[model samples]
Target chain A: AQSVTQLDSQVPVFEEAPVELRCNYSSSVSVYLFWYVQYPNQGLQLLLKYLSGSTLVKGINGFEAEFNKSQTSFHLRKPSVHISDTAEYFCAVTLKGGGNKLTFGTGTQLKVEL
Target chain B: GAGVSQSPSNKVTEKGKDVELRCDPISGHTALYWYRQSLGQGLEFLIYFQGNSAPDKSGLPSDRFSAERTGGSVSTLTIQRTQQEDSAVYLCASSHNSYGVEQYFGPGTRLTVT
Candidate 1:
């Protein structure tokens, strides 16, 4: 079975500061990785995904993540964050050739302060 | 275009009662999925439906949980004899038929079993 682990349960940062949310996964087979953000009272929105090709994948709102095959980690990063970036971020994984059902990590709440 | 939509954004029901959550996927999406988000469990896949294929019920927690997709568009997740443990946000997502496509999520239905 595949699983995702997010080491940080909550991350606090000041506005305009850099942020990184770490994610690790355990899967014997190859997998696809994704990052999603859920704002208050809203559905989750896809931040970025690492399917194939480049290890460095950039996503919306100036966020990005790197898929490190060696460490089995896909960490989300943003050079600078805004107060609007405050939300719960989730890392997910699914088998490459298997079904599309996603295995999600315990989300990391990003609280951006002024 | 409109994104995935879920009905009854919030539901309050008593224990032992039954509840139904609805999900309307984006038009032309061939895959739909149901997931549950709770403080204890984070996020977990519950069921999956793809075009004409057998729905994957492997992720369902128990027999009391069931889901069905009609006309390959709308889906309903039925929880019978709900318990306090069933109080959580039920999220729905949809994706295109192609491999490695992103799954768009809906604003989840928050269920509170008293």
Candidate 2:
């Protein structure tokens, strides 16, 4: 079985400040990692994914994540954030060849303070 | 392009009643998935359908939850004997395939059990 854990339930950062949302996973087999964003009363939208090759993965809206095998983590980062970046972010993982099913985390709420 | 769509954005039902949620996947997509989202718990996979094949129901929390995809384009999730614990936002998503594809999500139906 595969599982995903998000370390912080919420992270507050000033607008234009750097932010990092941590995510960890537990799985013995090969896996794929993904990040999603959810705004107020909206559905989740794909942010980024790490399938293979490059460890640093860039996503939409100036977000990125790094897949670290040694650390067993896929932490999302943003060099600079805007007020509109405040949202709930989810980290997910799935066993290789598991198709499209995802094991999601409890989510990290990015609260952008003006 | 049109994205995945779900019907009945909100639902209020009495305990013991059955409710059915609908999903219309993106055209030409071959995989559809159902998930649950609540206040604390992020997103939990409920079921997944691939083309016309049997669905993967391993993630379903209970037998009360069941889903079906017809004509390979749409899906319906039926919750039997609605319990207060079943209250959550039911989300529907679709992807081209399971091979690490990004799943597009719908607005989700918020089900409230009374």
Among all candidates shown, the one with the greatest lDDT: 1
Per-model chain B TM-scores are 0.98, 0.96
**Cα error, candidate 1, residue A67 (Å):** 0.9
Native-to-model Cα distance after best TM-score fit, residue B71 in candidate 1, in Å: 1.2
* Each candidate's interface RMSD: 0.8, 0.9
Docking class of 2: high
- Per-residue lDDT of B31 in model 2: 90
lDDT of candidates 1 onward, in order: 0.96, 0.93
Give candidate 1's TM-score: 0.98
Candidate 1 backbone collisions, by pair: none
Q: For model 1, what is the error of residue A88's alpha carbon versus the real structure, in angstroms, after optimal superposition?
A: 0.6
Regions of model 1 farther than 4 Å from truth: none
Clashing pairs in 2: none
- Per-residue CA lDDT of model 2 for A10-112, tens digit only, reads 9999999999999999998999999999998899999999999999999999999999999899999999999999999999987888677989999999999
Q: Model 2 residue B99 lDDT? A: 86
**TM-score for each prediction?**
0.98, 0.98
